[model samples]
Target: MVQEEKIPSHVAIIMDGNGRWAKKRGLPRIFGHRAGVKAVEKIVSHAANIGIKYLSLFAFSTENWLRPKDEVSGLMMLLSEFVDKKFFEIIEKDIKFVVSGRLIDLPDEPRSKVLKLIETSKNNTGMVLNLALNYGGRKEIVDAVNKILASDIKDIDEKVFSGFLYSPEVPDIDLLIRTSGEMRISNFMLWRLAYAELYFTKTLWPDFDEAEFDKAIFDYQNRDRRFGMTDEQIRRGNI
Candidate 1:
């Protein structure tokens, strides 16, 4: 059982295997993406109920643009529709909606909807729902560096550099869950995942549920995070 007090403050997820899920069913990839949206709905609600303070979902990656044009357009449409459908629920639930990526690269419809979501929910005092659309960890670091260069900041440290990130106020990830049996981070949250506990599941993203999420939390709870200290040091409360 996961302890309530030990619940991770920030949980990030790499939602993968949608294409594979659709391929396995001999259906179009868009169908899989559609199914993945439903899973996102379920997991978001469950995360709030389970005391997850911050839930970041990697919805679209910068590399995803290399895919077929039709599929890309379809994804944009889906995102716009999803935001429109969930706009009221987000406000009513007091969820703070945030986006971690370049909104300028998004299609006009989706970009406008996303900005609206952030603006409308700015005052919500509840669990934060961060969507990583068109996000690449490497790109994020580069973008931050460019900002620093433009400001003519010669001296900088990790702490100061972090403030330039797309979502600077969000804390470092505590738990990172990747589905579809993928073991790689794939350029997601490069800076924020410095010391995060990673959990990979064989279950596809469309099939990931509350129970699957709990299993990851349980696994995380059993681990002893020494963070470079010896076990004896941890036992002696010398962390």
Candidate 2:
């Protein structure tokens, strides 16, 4: 059995291919997205069960607004439903809820729901569930830069600037997983993923479950995280 000590402290996921999954099944795209929420619930429980401290999910991106209006509206409705149905479960599990992204742009009902959930879960002690809604990696970085420039700090390094992000309390991403065979980061957590290990899988978001998640964890266990040290130096413990 693999040692549980090797499990990553934080895992970020780019949940993709919902529409494609729906198309493959000859169902409406919204059906796939709805199903994806179920997958989200399952994965959250599994991550907490396996001792992951933080799980950040890229649910919607800033660029997603360019899609058809109907689709966007549908997504918002689904998000509202998700919060209404899952907030209790999240609280029961002691999972703290947080949201990243341009939340001011969301509609009033969904925005209010998100805020309520965050407030309700703020005191929880279990895993953190960070939902990236209307988020963009580049946008987050740019916002951080703007904030730094606007502040009174004389000099701002990477560490200093990171503190100005949406959730500065969180640590850097330890592992990033992108589903549906996507090899790119898709503008997700560009700054935070500086040293994160990347994992890609062909499984689509709606179909990703505990088994697939375990596979990613298993793969992560075998990696050599030298962090730029030469192989021989790493082996000899000589930095």
lDDT of 1 by residue, 61-91 (tens): 9999999999999999999989998899989
Would you give me the overall lDDT of model 2? 0.92
lDDT tens per residue, model 2, 20-128:
9999999989998999989998999999999999999999999999998988999999999999999899999999999889999999999999999999999999999
What pairs collide in candidate 1? none
TM-score per prediction, in order, is 0.97, 0.96
Whole-model Cα lDDT of every candidate shown, in order: 0.94, 0.92
Off by over 4 Å in 2: 236-239
Off by over 4 Å in 1: none
